[model samples]
Target: MKRYPIRAAKYAVYLIILFFILFALLRAFGSASPMSVLWTTSRGLMFLGVVVVFALLYPFFGFTRKRLTFNAAERADDVERIMAMCGFKRIGSENRPADDMLFEAASTAKKVAMMWEDQVRITTDADGVSFIEGNRKEVVRAAFRMGTYIA
Candidate 1:
């Protein structure tokens, strides 16, 4: 959650900007004192700005569309094992065995158009393996932690 601090800082700055802008607009056209106008509009305008920002960003960051690859340093089987240890379930193995390597990030009961989560396709063979896309650092950390939890 190191990113949380950065995001929070950005939000704080935005709120301050919004407060000043609203205060200025209200003072320019209204009869109220600057301090009185701020007292009246500050909280409501700040909340509105924050809501707009959140609504715009929630879908973008909460459900990201990224195609990230694994580095050459990682091995093929190890990658597969790590994926399995994490929550990703294979797409298919019965009709298309090789195609089973394609996986969506979430293993929830409802499967949609794969829009709800990230996806990863692993290409492994006698040749060295590489990933088409995945959340790399978090995936690696989770997989490594799995090693300690196995009975």
Candidate 2:
């Protein structure tokens, strides 16, 4: 499963809010002693800290994250290269296939293309192109520009 950075961040924010709410409730209804309040607050902070850490690390550790970089132009070129590698031939208007197998293959190919598209993003710069994945936008040069072929 993919863990989106924005989603993780939102979850972290929610956890922080919940921790504060719990701390407040505990303070209001629990013991009035300084030690008890401090202990409760510390525990709440620890829980919030753990959530924050996990959120920050999720992008780096997520299995669905593809760590690759390319600029807009290079990205376009890569797409072309990948299409060629996948043996994707351009369908002519006059020779369009009208069979069920063709339709299934097209649908499957569209899904695979979408998956690759989602795995990478291209950003342009004066220095050239940069690729970004999720929240970590870093320029990587050794990306696998290969498309998946569904038979």
If scored against the real structure, what TM-score would every candidate get?
Answer: 0.36, 0.29
Q: What are the lDDT figures for the candidates, one per model?
A: 0.49, 0.42
Cα RMSD to native, each candidate? 11.5, 12.8
**Counted clashes in each candidate structure:** 0, 2
Error of 1 at 136 (Å): 6.5
Instruction: Encode model 2's per-residue lDDT on 82-132: one tens digit a residue.
Output: 534433322331443211001111345643533322233333445653433
Model 2 lDDT-worst window of ten: 96-105
- Colliding pairs, model 1: none
Q: List the candidate 2 regions with Cα displacement exceeding 4 Å.
A: 1-8, 11-45, 56-119, 125-132, 135-142, 146-151
Best by TM-score: 1
Compose the digit string of candidate 1's lDDT tens values, residues 1-151.
Answer: 3344444455455556766787778778894465644337876567667755774564335322222244322443454566666656556645444523566655554233223334555554444433343444434544354344421
Give the backbone clash total of model 1: 0
